[model samples]
Target: MRKERILYIYPTLSSFIKGDAEILSREYEVTHFRVHPTSWHSLLRSLISQLFHLIFNLRKYDIVYIWFADYHSFLPTLFCKRFKKRCYIVAGGYDVCREKKYGYGSFTNPIRGFMTARSIKNCTTVIAVSKNIKQIIRHVFPSTNCVTIYNGVVLKPGKEDVEKESLVLTVSMASTAKNVFIKGIDRIIEVADLMQETKFILIGTERQLLEKIGYKIPDNLQVLGFVDHSHLQEIYSKSKVYCQLSRRESFCLALAEAMLYNCNPVITNIGGMPEVTGKNGFIINEYSAQNCSFVIKKALEAKTNSLGRERILSEFTIETRAEKILNLLESN
Candidate 1:
């Protein structure tokens, strides 16, 4: 039997997409399409390129696997349905989320929502990253075929050997006020204020935005702008605790990666975070600075072990995800 040819569509070449794509390539003849645009000009150019590519070559492939139900996947999914080709759409967190405060989600924006809905309706299957997402899709489109599949993580084998400091860490794309609030940056700041003795390292873009908002960076908190994975690995090795107090998440890649470095997690009780933490880490029952501080303080005192890494190796590794996905694709 011949291997199936798949057209893999993604919004961006994000870490989340790359991890799964690496494994997907091994099983199928994958043609990866990155539709994330950097500017308005590039957006138009890329769409034109995609339209031409699909119009000419879409029939050559057997499956159209869309990573996110955004504009990029809309056209290809439509094409697949029109031509009666097998296609599935993978729901990344934001695409299927319906958060009122964030003012954005797959079904939040009128125009974008229509495109997303159409894409979902057209596809044969909707692979949600978490149980929460699966529930949301089933509630909205009760007849849609939605399945839960956890995103994969890159495994770092053999327990982390670095001696952990009293360092508490968090990583996010907190460049704006909305992002800060949505990512629980304010809560982290408040926790840092209360816990003067504990050192907090927040790694993300836009450290200056916090200053502008008069956040008054406490002496205990040090905001380091974006660092690549290599530097992140170094920080993760030295850190005793990792915090992800986000308002919502599909599947937090950072929390999983941090776990591989043996950093105990202190995350908010929302979205797919709990699934990622499993029973290995502490969960913040409330979305408050006081609650987050309590969890972090408690987590810091706990003995560090391979429990976090073990969780990833057993249930969330790239190979594990790939095998499940390959089996599902082959089933049809």
Candidate 2:
């Protein structure tokens, strides 16, 4: 049997999408198209160019796989109507959400919201990253065929010999300035101030901005600006507990990565975090500093186990995700 050709489209060459593209390429002949934009002018230009490109070349591929239902997906989704092409959209967090508090999310903008709705409504399938997201999609695009496929990661389990330190770790991108508060960096700082004995490491690029926003850097809290992946893995291994006290999350990839290194999770009970942590880690029912502190303390006393890593290996590997995707493609 001949392998099918797939045109994989994404807003940018983001790490997670790049990982998925690589996995998809293993089984299918994949051509990648990136509609990345740095400014409003560029966004419009890129969308126009991608639309023309898709319109002219739509027949070359057997399927079109698009990531996110924002501006980038709009054109291809529009052309799919005339061409009658089978296109699948993988909904990342922001594109599928209406996180008004942060003043972000595709659905927050009227134009983008319209584009997102049309794209999702027309796509052959909608791949929601979590069960929570699937529910959101069903409510918003009731007639659309949406399915839950938990995001997967490349697991590089840390060696058992690395002695776990008395450190608590939380990682963020820091580029989303508002997300510092949304992802509970503010609460992390508060908890650090109270738990003066324990060391808390917050990794991200916006440390300066976070401090500028009047978050007093406590003595026990160490805000290490951006670290490379290897360094992050080392920190993940050394940390006793990984905290993800977010207001909402589609799937907390950081928490999952930390689990791969055998760090016990202390995540908030929001979105798919509970699904990711499962019964292996502590889930905070409340988002108060007191509740987070209590959970961290309890997580510290609990012995580290392979349950987290084992759970990910069985269910959330990139290979597993690829297999599911392939099954979907072939079945259709």
Candidate 3:
């Protein structure tokens, strides 16, 4: 049979929201829809564009693939259901972790009910990026099809990991996971306060509101605004340690990226952190200032060299993640 035509929908092209579904498109005839999914109202604008695409050429594609968080998949899945076409949704991370983290009371809590088991049952399969996400999918779908595949990360050698002077950087969205709460920013401040020798940097913006609300930023802590991967690489290359202390996460690309760069990671014991870090990188439990200080101190003391670098290369590489994902997708 001719290779199946696929259309993968994204929130926007500028979000830098990378996922494995796009990798499939590269091998097949994939049409990527970069939408702006800000709210339910945003769908109005998206529907206009998508309806045009659907009416004009929906039949040209064999599969309709949606790459986004929960509820957002409803748009594409609706088309597939109406047309009786085979489609798959890629639950990057949010589909699985968000509802659980925020609970059924939050603004997005309704996703728990609307984006339910029946949604997954109506499709061929839902691609979950992490094992935690796989479990979440199975919990929702129960008896439907669910496949767990990691996000791709290509490993490189010689660009080996090395400890920097006192540069600790956190590269991520300012608002994701309500960073104001249990995320590591507070602890980063605490860590910085404890060790005056280090400069704690919080990269990325979109959280100016929270930052203004007494986020406990200290003199040692540096808010570097937002820096892309090219700039981030230079920071990571010169950084000593990486920290990921999120209240919730499915598969953190930044954490994995930090590992590939060989920055010794000091992560919290939650969600996919333990799953990804394993015994490869330094890990911590509590997000308290006290605990953050302790963990940072310990990680800073450890040897950030070839040993940790080798582990991330062997496992978290994009090549390996892509191969796993492709094999899983092709097997079905």
Clashes of 2: 0
Q: Where in model 3 is the C-alpha error above 4 Å?
A: 1-3, 14-22, 82-84, 98-108, 154-158, 161-163, 176-182
Ranking by TM-score: 2, 1, 3
lDDT value, residue 138 of candidate 1: 93
Write one digit per residue (lDDT tens) for candidate 2, span 158-250. Answer: 897678988899987656567787677888889999899999999974668887887888999888888878888889989999988888688
Of the pair 2 and 3, which is ahead by TM-score?
Answer: 2
Which TM-score value belongs to model 2?
0.95
- Model 2, position 109, has a per-residue lDDT of 95
Please give the lDDT score for candidate 2: 0.85
**Which parts of model 2 are misplaced by more than 4 Å?**
none
lDDT value, residue 254 of candidate 2: 82
| TM-score top scorer | 2
- What clash count goes with each model? 0, 0, 4
RMSD of 2: 1.6
lDDT, model 1, position 21: 81
